[model samples]
Target: MGFDLVSRVRLYKVLERIGCSPKQFDGSPSTPSETNRGVKQGCVQASNLFGIYFAAMLRHAFGGFREVCGDFRLNISLKKTNIMGINTQHPPNIHISNYQLEAVNEFTYLGSVVTNDLSLDTEIDRTGSASATFAELAKRVWENTKLTLTTKILVYKVSILSTLLYGCATWNLYSRQKKRLNIYNLRNQWKMLKIKWYDHITNNEALQQTSIPSIYTLLCQQCLRWLGHVCRMEDGRIPKDLLHGELNQGSRPRG
Candidate 1:
């Protein structure tokens, strides 16, 4: 297919990933703000966290953006804050907007300057074995990363399935409010969704090849690579250990 057609398809795939439909978003406006829309509590939090992870992951992988979106704004509701157990110490009632600002462009995860003297990641309750808990947490992170990566690819494809899927959703969403439809916001969401969805691809240049990447197979490859390294460390049988140890130290100590 021609590059223009391919790019258009990829754009449609983004709408599907974000639960929007092509029929609903076609010919949409150019600058719809994300803040005006009502989003579910869970989805809002997920999108915020996604911004941070995407920035960090992209930097870690060392990729360049085809285009940069400057005014992309994501609003997260403070009322639904779940510390995963760390909120009591910090007090949910405290206003985060008042504190000093620390911006992490790579990590996108923003935190307010807390005068209350509390660490966000501090452990509050010790209910499980540390090793087991660590293992479980690691597994969960890996799984989530894999799933999100797959979603990103599918969105990038913007294939026929994506178009049909998203067109239906958008049609239904706007069918209710026809007169006051904000085409501008619709288009903006498409742009934001593209950034949100193509995260892993932006990080891994290999993923941005002309052909679509296989999500499941690549995920398995990552899992195997991680597990193999872990197993080698546990068994004390990693080949060329001495060489690696020396190289890691950047020259050997002469006795």
Candidate 2:
């Protein structure tokens, strides 16, 4: 059965008592000579309940949870429960009681697609497609004769661009992907301006006419702003801790 508010609270308490923690990354350090880097590279702590190393612990926790559910007269749907592996070469075989859990290569969590390889290609494609769909849905607004160009631009930014750039602050886009997304953004802007494919106008000129920055520039700005915000977060917060963690062990990557 799905967890109600009270059940969720109880579950949270149990999880906390069992020492469950959030996922963490131990990044490489900057200087090769710095021997005192606290957390070493490739060192990981499996704080997640679903970690493979903690399968036995998870099974025990699940048993406890099952007992709790029984007391509340709630039915647990074993078939609906799934385990997903990230960057795993082989699928893990795990069981709780007599039921074997199924493993999946990818799953959607919090509206984001998480895959075994942890690559963003699928996510980018999905976001791009969704953005295009939203833009197409707003085609009538783009083509409306009564609306001013400024108003249409506002609508495009608020509706289309916002959708396109959702969660972009966390993206680490390659040059080719950035180029492709920028081209798509430019095409949409051209469509809104009623410019033909054969139009001799340059991208810079089009951007100037629209009075909007390029998609790449916008993404960079958003990422920088998000970094600033994370840096300013108070200590003990996960994002802040990750940002300031002393895990890097070698020379930083040269961009």
Candidate 3:
């Protein structure tokens, strides 16, 4: 009641200033903040740093890691240290022990081509071998009138499809990829039935003729089976850990 609205606002601002900078009245000198320059990123958050200072952060981390390795008397092979940035246009040029590591767009790990874009087409290329496998036994199995369609289908499942979709249980397929797989399955079925495109047979008719499920259905079945296996696996198993483990870090802050 004693002060106007303007006076009250001014008073609040003055109190806030006094509360925030207590060191001004306490006779203690304020310490200067450490900039991103030559800063250790492990202790400091990288989000606060500018992009130009990122090299310093890398250098700091590399130096610290090398020091730790030196203390442990462990050798790091510079040739084995390769840098790859996924889904990025500009990859970072990384140097370890002053030797620049090779930057790769894709690399093979255990026979799988792990590309930067995670393209399913690369995986599809491996299906050529499955095609070859399917055709290899055409004279004895697929073409044999003595074999029932069911038997042929079973043989296709065990021989051809197995080779085609070796790691399909863990597949994260796009609509296009799913369609391609379906087409591949249907085309192979038509070939087994000796039905051509000009035979006036619909894809569904062909499916009914073979009494076979879609490739997507097979994928779902395999995925469910894999899920069951993962569920039964020991807690320390890698697959179990991958399925059930909680991440230490969270998503980046919204812009």
lDDT of 2 by residue, 1-255 (tens): 223212333443456666754233555433434233332334463224223323333455645766755554345577777787777788988776788888888777756777888887777776566566655756478778888899988887887777677788988888888887888889888887888868888889899989989988999999999999998888899998877777458776664
Give each model a TM-score: 0.19, 0.68, 0.56
Each candidate: RMSD: 24.7, 14.6, 21.2
Off by over 4 Å in 2: 1-5, 8-77, 131-135, 248-255
Residue ranges of candidate 3 with Cα displaced over 4 Å: 1-83, 92-101, 135-141, 144-151, 198-200, 236-238, 241-255
Per-residue lDDT of candidate 3, residues 72-119 (tens digit):
333566766667788999976977677777888877664566788877
**Model 3 residue pairs with clashes:** none
Model 1 TM: 0.19
- Which stretches of model 1 miss by more than 4 angstroms? 1-36, 43-70, 74-125, 128-255
| lDDT-best of 1 and 3 | 3
